[model samples]
Target: PARRPPPSARRLMAEAGVAAAAIPPSGPGGQIRKEDVVRALEARPPAPAPATAPAPVAPAPQALRAVPEGDRERVVPMTPLRKTVARRLVEAQHTAAILTTFNEVDMTRVLALREQHGERFLARHGVKLGFMSFFVKASVEALRAFPAVNGEIRGESVVYRDRYDIGVAVGGGKGLVVPVVRDADARSFAEIEEAIAGLAKKAKDNRITMEDLAGGTFTISNGGIYGSLLSTPILNPPQSGILGLHKIERRPVVEDGDRIVVRPMMYLALSYDHRLVDGREAVSFLVRVKECIEDPERMLLEV
Candidate 1:
């Protein structure tokens, strides 16, 4: 005999317009919990429309296989992590006055620096010198210069953080997960590389814990690795800003004296909460990042 859902669960199912038989019980002793009701609501199909005149439909081309309609489509359930991501993304868009600002950076100096020190840095640090370290360092400098970008909006107030806990977005086995690099401002290049590597491995193995995904003052998402040419990254909630990095390509540009030259350029986008950060500050923050990447010495000099 199956146990019936409690009165609270029944009320929830009623409010959600789902039938009791439609929800599966996962609670102890075959009881339907509120969570089960919610899942059912999420999975429920739309109600059929009232009967009306049937519209003419076109026949499928004979060349197109004769496979059944069901065989051509598949339905898969969203993982818990993916569901949370979807919810948070929608929440961020709805709650915040989100805006994106774009800028292009010449990666010539940074690439040269990497090529010059790749072997030695790897030999000493046991982690290859990657572009992320440079970006993280540059972002730290930029965030420090524009504190509002690193701050969050708490009802009626803007909270600024002195510590830099940067979240590096990585694709995990489950989905995309952002694991924080705690106190990034104090970490050396080697330490930052090691931290990102460890977090990436954990994400790939699906062994990341909630603590690793906890509080971050800012987030950096590198879509360049996946060959994304350009994209506007959405803000991670509670954080005022997110930085999106795109692919580096050789493009012709005008230099000093109007000389056209080929340069490796990467597009940078800063998506910020307009409620907390003004347009001037957001643009300045992105420009600051561009300057640090282009020069590569300003970050070292604390400029």
Candidate 2:
């Protein structure tokens, strides 16, 4: 004869986060996940009783009680788009050889230039002038000089692309998205800003398309929006390099002739696939980028 479970224990345990105390009876096979345990402990429970002489006080109710197999029925369930993301993240971890190089750029020059010119530029062009356009132009120049950063490896083959397609990072409530602006090398700052604005607006509206997410030769993650001082960003799939932009803050520093002065500074991080890039090559490429950005005239001259 099959033994019946203690109905009193089973009924009390089903209420969620119930302590296992005086549970009459229950089923097996359902241990709570650790996250669930932590969540359960966060809520206060009743105070303990005074010391007892000795009664087998039923064990405190469990964080969770398992449902009996006989109680389950076959059912179809919906799936999430997360599996595709998981597979790509796992693949990036396994196959790609990753490396990150760090550098800092004094934003004093760039910020002052923008502050002096941004309002007029915006009014004249009807678009807000932003630093992304400056960095994107600099990165494109570097990518051209060090084509390896823009190239990818396929089964021991070096594939180089002459076109520059830069990905701009945007944030929404859910997570970050990178929308590409193609032929970035050929576009002016105003054009780049227009493209960035449209993509960011679309991302916020949850209306970004698959095409907008494809074929990015390089990625720039502007974590500055969240006020991160510095971070090494992960590579986007099929792209060999990512640039991390951090918050611009004022800090004191020594200038030429050994005088201390406060200046606006921002940290930049370049993370690339080490399998396809060398440290010397990577650092030099970033140095060139920094030079172009700090001295905007070099970018205008296309030097």
Candidate 3:
């Protein structure tokens, strides 16, 4: 004989379509815990016919058993980090006058540069040469040229930042976290790569702290790693803009001599708070990033 369960546990079992007698007690004094009910409910199969009366009725189809409802669904509460992300996303939508500008860049030169210097760079820095450092440096130059992208609206006035602290969005075990790269403008490419690698490791291992996640004037999200072809990213709160980078693909395009040729291309999206940045400035800022990415040397020359 089984002891009666608490009102709440009984209600949960009833809702889960689990019989009180079916679950074994795992709590103290042979009491059935709510978790016991949940586990039993999750494991219970569809009801079969009576042992002696099953000859007349056919079994339910396998497809029917796969229908998603009741026992098929398991609900869990949102984690605190997920809740925070949701709140900030909604707040960004409501608070900022957001707009996304788009462009595409030829990656021929950047790829060539990487192929030429990647091995030595990796040996020297102990971190693989990656595309992120190039983009970070390019973004800094563009931010310098178009200060409005780095500016934030504080109450009634706009505040401009002189130093570049760029946030790189990384997927952590908890959720999407943006860890800031401090003084990115002044850091060398190797230094930027090393910092990004360290921050990424911290994020993945759940060692990231509040200081690592704060004080970013701008953000860059690389959806390309996850195979996103193009997407309009949302703004992070208090920050005026975020740059979305997508997968690089080989596409046919007209080159300098109007000859149709295949080239590696990547689509770029810049999502900005329109209240602080004008459309012209936003477009120009993206174009500047494109120029630097396409030529890499332009970033060195500060052009």
Candidate No. with top TM-score: 1
User: How does candidate 2 fare on TM-score?
Assistant: 0.73
lDDT for each residue of candidate 3 in 11-122, tens digit (9 for 90 to 100): 7777667776788887677788765765565345545546884357676797676545655668666654565577679989999999999999999999999999999998
Q: Rank the candidates by TM-score, best first.
A: 1, 3, 2
Worst 10 residues of 3 by lDDT: 41-50
lDDT of each: 0.90, 0.78, 0.88
The residue-by-residue lDDT of candidate 2 on 1-303, one tens digit each, is 224334432342454436543222223444333223223332345355689787665664678685677796775321112333454567677878888999888877788888999999999989998999999999999999999999998767989989999998898433577889999999999999999999999988877764687679999999998999999888887788999999999999899889999988888999898989889888988898889878987898987
Q: Lowest-lDDT window of 10 residues in candidate 1?
A: 38-47
lDDT of 3: 0.88
Task: Give the per-residue Cα lDDT of candidate 1 at 221.
Answer: 99
**Candidate with more favorable, higher lDDT: 2 or 3:** 3
Q: Is candidate 1 or candidate 2 better by lDDT?
A: 1
Q: Which stretches of candidate 3 lie over 4 Å from their true place?
A: 1-71
TM-score on alpha carbons, each prediction:
0.79, 0.73, 0.77
- TM-score-better candidate, 1 vs 2: 1
- Evaluated at residue 175, the lDDT of candidate 1 is 82
